[model samples]
Target: MSLNFHTMHDKNPDIVASLARLHEHHFGARPTVITGLQGDGSDRQIFRLSSDANEPVIGIYGPNRRENEAFISFSRALHQHAIPVPIIYTYDADAHIYLESDLGDVTLLEWSNQHDDSSSVLTMYRQVISWLPKVQLTSKDSIDYTKCHPFAAFRREAMQFDLDYFQSSFLSRFLRIRLDNAALANDFNLLIAHLLRAPFDAFMYRDFQSKNIMICNEQPFFIDYQSGRKGALQYDVASLLFDANVNLSHSFREAMLEFYIRETMRYIPIQEKKFLTFYYDFALLRMLQALAAFSFLVFQKGKSYFMKSIPNALQNIAFLLTQDDCMLRRLPELRRLFEEDVLNNPQALS
Candidate 1:
């Protein structure tokens, strides 16, 4: 019985054998229950494997070897810097199976849903914001850039990838909006240039939204940072405040942005005016990136539930397109597609 793997015998026997051995090696006994846990947007399988004697640990079965390497490497480095990330206990590289301390499942998104007080929620977000600079400035040098998945830094090509992703996934493929190709490409270049103007010396948590945050013991612990790389600080800040899930009001967003600037200035030299100028530019980029992701999930993966977020994302895009400093003004053809075609006709997106 000690060697017998529980629950996972049917899902993937090959992985179960390796995971069972790893579990037994660490806990000295077979897990009593290997309960399946939820996953994010990745193709990773997770479980809670535990027995009566030992505290439960999160079991992971990752299909992507490079992503696994990035997560494990960053986890170790972040842990060393006293960051509040989950600790990696053990892993079987060949099997793509690993174990880490479980932090429970209360995400900042869930926590926000449960708590409604403006002041309290603001304080909570402030706390989350306060840690971003520390995560960026402190543990950044310790992070092995080579371990970053796909790319080691947020470069022009990466930004273009997300833009092209949105265009392919939602605009051209789904909506079939006839945008001015030359103008669209011009606008993309302008946006990319504006984003890269900021200091790019910090760890950019590529998806720093609420759902990626875990509320453990009333403290914030970050996860899903395997996609992170060296990039401008404004992008992550924009990601958090402008998160589609919470959809913090503009006033609150402004207050939180101010708080972030203050927190960031404590550790690094932040030109407030310069940071604000580039903030919304990155915000637009983040929203479009998210829209691209949601669209891909719905259309390609057939996750129909993601379709619900499209309208809100489109609304955010519509707002950004109207701003004077937004790149949309510089790209009228793309702006017309959003204004007259996609955003104006919601049915086009569906």
Candidate 2:
């Protein structure tokens, strides 16, 4: 999964020269700097290219060519539907290099952190909520799900992927917690069946969170939507509200859920009561997936910032665990293991 991008290493003269050539060919001038940007969990290498003559552009070098293609194709579809995404100026499929409009450095997460006022935060969150339904409902007929990376739908198989990711990456690798594999599998099956029963009619922004949202001129522009797929409506909302890094307040989360329900009704008819009922189910599942990712990144990958999020993720899981209506409660063995391995042993996580 090696990337073919340039950075500030003096030893790699060839890499640097190649990047300069790319900048000159694209923007008519060699970039003054091709600074590498910090990455999350993905294997992709992102660089910010800037020059005196040309406006700033982002040059992305991803190892997986298919994922890059997914982003380019999906972004174009979103742009066509008037959704805000970084405009893909050019992409080289053979090299897996992508050059796109630079949406600037401010993410919704960073922007929200700068403001302490609760009302202001809510206002920003509300704006984000308003646009989600549009992303899910708009261009419903036109999107080619085949272009979605990995899969087209968040179906049972896709749900299983997250479950398996948690089991192998977190439970086994990070926590070193052995489990009754059969029991856990049974529980996973039940949970998947329940989620599959939810309304699966909209385009789910698989990773709809504050960090992936860029604030360009105070307006939200979506990025990193390569994982977009057809899935249950509640999953996206859950991802937004229960985001580990953001950790939005409980009251605000409730308000946003209602806002999403109301906003979504504008585009399609939904049973508010039913949607509300299934929201927590999705939220709980999303929390599991997120924690699994956090565990892998923090523990296995040795990325320390993700460790700070463990407490928040655990807190969210604890809250869900206490709820009598929780679908996860049905799996007693899994519950006991999680309670002992994760919830009860908070000292180790810290």
TM-scores of all predicted structures: 0.94, 0.93
lDDT agreement of model 2 with the native: 0.82
Q: Best by lDDT, which number?
A: 1
Tens digit per residue, CA lDDT, model 2, 1-350: 13344455522444445656677787788787777777778877777877888888988877898898889988888899988889998877776677899999999999999989989888888888899999999966667888887988999888999999988877787777878999899988988888888888898889998889998888889988889899889999998998888877778888999899999999999998778667887888888788789888877777878888878877888877877667867877778877877777754357
Candidate 1 per-residue lDDT over residues 149-224, each given as its tens digit: 8989988989999999988887876677766778788888887887777778998889999889999999999999
Report the number of backbone clashes for model 1.
0
Clashes of each: 0, 0
Instruction: Name the weakest run of 10 consecutive residues (lDDT summed) in model 2.
Output: 1-10
Candidate 1 TM-score, C-alpha based: 0.94
